[model samples]
Target: MTDPRWGEAFSTAFAQLTALWPDKVAIGAAVSGLCALMETDVALAYICFGALTADMTARVAVCCKRNRPLCRGLKRALPRYVCYLVFIVMAWAAQVAFQRGLHVGLPIVDIMLAYLILTDMASIIGHLHYLGVPVPPVLKWLVFGGREQLKRKAREAAGRERR
Candidate 1:
């Protein structure tokens, strides 16, 4: 006959294992989902970085055409690029932590990414305008502000100058 103590020990071990199985499965699923989300975010960040680099290149080209010192323009731009890169990385990390740890449903990361994209687009549009490319007035209004706002500001400045 089988020993009673051995049967009891085996049953106890199986019960404990089964009890912990759901927790393990939950943790595994969370980690898997987080990894997938992180991968998507990384790809998007790379695209944002590419846009920023293009903007920087356009600025440098403008500076070069204007007979400015290339080194000075690059020196001014390099720090800004580095800061943006750091911001992207930090934003990714913070987003992951908040979304997973705090269970936040807010779209903070999406807003940040959109802001970066819009800023780069505005810079590119400005550079194109400087290069004598005829960007549509509507684009300028959309990216910078409405034409009425600009006119108002100009009128205010002129009014101040007369005083």
Candidate 2:
């Protein structure tokens, strides 16, 4: 029989995921094995999760403020390309976790789960923002708190572009 703890962990993770995005049950399933590791190791998993979450938020806020077809310029786009590289590496790791969780194992799965969970949450939040949904004020201050610097940079870039 499968461990009851596994079921418990999956259920809790699934509930949390659905709370973030109503259709995230599949994503929850994808990361469920990693969730099991989270149940086993709380502090480390959460710290990694928080780090990835912050990283992703900054990327999203920056990208949202950028021009479309993101990689247009050589010099001006270097920072955005760096963020893209970070995203690509994280995505590759998530694929490894989903495809080879059995072979690669715990710490890999744990870290990937944190990254996947937070990325999934960020996607949902970005979609809601695009749809004109209002963010909860507390969440705004927490997740988007660093946006002022990004805004300043964007304005500086705009002034340069107009010159």
Backbone clash tally for model 1? 0
Off by more than 4 A, model 2:
1-106, 141-163
Q: Residues 17-67, candidate 1: write the lDDT tens digits.
A: 999999999976764564366544544565666778888898899999899
- The regions of model 1 sitting more than 4 angstroms off are 1-43, 145-163
Error of 2 at 99 (Å): 18
Q: What lDDT tens digits, residue by residue, belong to model 2 across residues 44-158? A: 3455455545544544555566654334333343464356436545645654664475353334334444444444455546656664778786765544543444445546744
Alpha-carbon lDDT of model 1 = 0.71
For all candidates, the clash counts are: 0, 0
Q: Which candidate leads the pack in TM-score?
A: 1
Please give the CA lDDT of all the candidate structures. Answer: 0.71, 0.51
